[model samples]
Target: MSTRAPDRFHVSSAVVLCTPGAADRLVETLAEMPNVEVHAAEQGKIIIVIEGKSSGEMGATLAAISSLPDVMAANMVFEHAENLEEGLINGHRTDAA
Candidate 1:
């Protein structure tokens, strides 16, 4: 018998462009979202990292961000997925296959 692991953990980074002087408000709003991290903000660009159980969840979050007022665009820059159970069992990363 075998037990299957849960869904892969998905991580993604995005560059969010906002209208002039909206970075501060956007950062504050993003900070309140679960599993979302604001890495930096300068000028009108905000760097954010988000984590989720699946790619669909991450994509949905990105879409929501892009639709926010003052947001000009939200583009994903990086993405990675890993099987946490496999990584933990081997004590090293065992990225999804």
Candidate 2:
């Protein structure tokens, strides 16, 4: 059986910081995530990517990350997957008149 990775673009939010250092600590806090990808690290800061299915899940994930001492701040870079989704829900026609 082959397993495919989850949608990367659908990434809800990220936990960014200098460094948590302790894998055990990070693991305990992010036990929900079966996997984690570390992008870059400097001095003691690093970027962690989180994949959440919904906004509520995303909020919880961020909260857990924030509780970590290493986390400086976590912010959602993009909202709601994409802008076009927002437009359609608001009743804006994509077909330019």
Candidate 3:
């Protein structure tokens, strides 16, 4: 018999650069995507956070963002992965003995 590991949760943050005039519209568009959250926008720069089940999923989203109109660049700044089966208690991880 084979057992599969629990799904891993991925979190990533990116900085997107866009035309100053397009900031508002771009923010609205990005905010509508699943697992994407627009954190801040100012002077043509946008900060966003994304959550997904895997690195591929997050990379796909980043690619999509980079392809959007008026987006000059979407650079991933940070990433974190958490194993779902890791001694989690009430959504927080506990040290194992």
Reference-based lDDT, each prediction? 0.89, 0.53, 0.93
- 8-96 per-residue lDDT for model 1 (tens digits): 88999999999998889899999998889999999999999999999899999999999999999999999999775674443444465
Ranking by TM-score: 3, 1, 2
Q: Mind giving the per-residue lDDT tens digits that candidate 2 earns over 1-97? A: 2243323224553545535575445544555554345555455444566665556666787776777676666665554454323324334435542
Give the per-residue Cα lDDT of candidate 1 at 89.
42
Candidate 3 RMSD to the real structure:
4.2
Where model 1 places Cα greater than 4 Å from the true spot, the runs are 3-5, 87-97
* Residue 61 lDDT (model 1): 96
Sorted by lDDT (best first), the order is 3, 1, 2
- The C-alpha stretches of model 2 lying farther than 4 A from their native spots are 1-9, 13-15, 19-32, 79-97
| Residue 24 accuracy (lDDT) in model 3 | 96
The number of the candidate with the highest lDDT is 3
Cand. 2 Cα-lDDT:
0.53
What are the per-model numbers of colliding residue pairs?
0, 4, 0
Q: lDDT, candidate 1, residue 23? A: 86
The TM-score that candidate 2 achieves is: 0.48
- TM-score winner between 1 and 2, please give it: 1
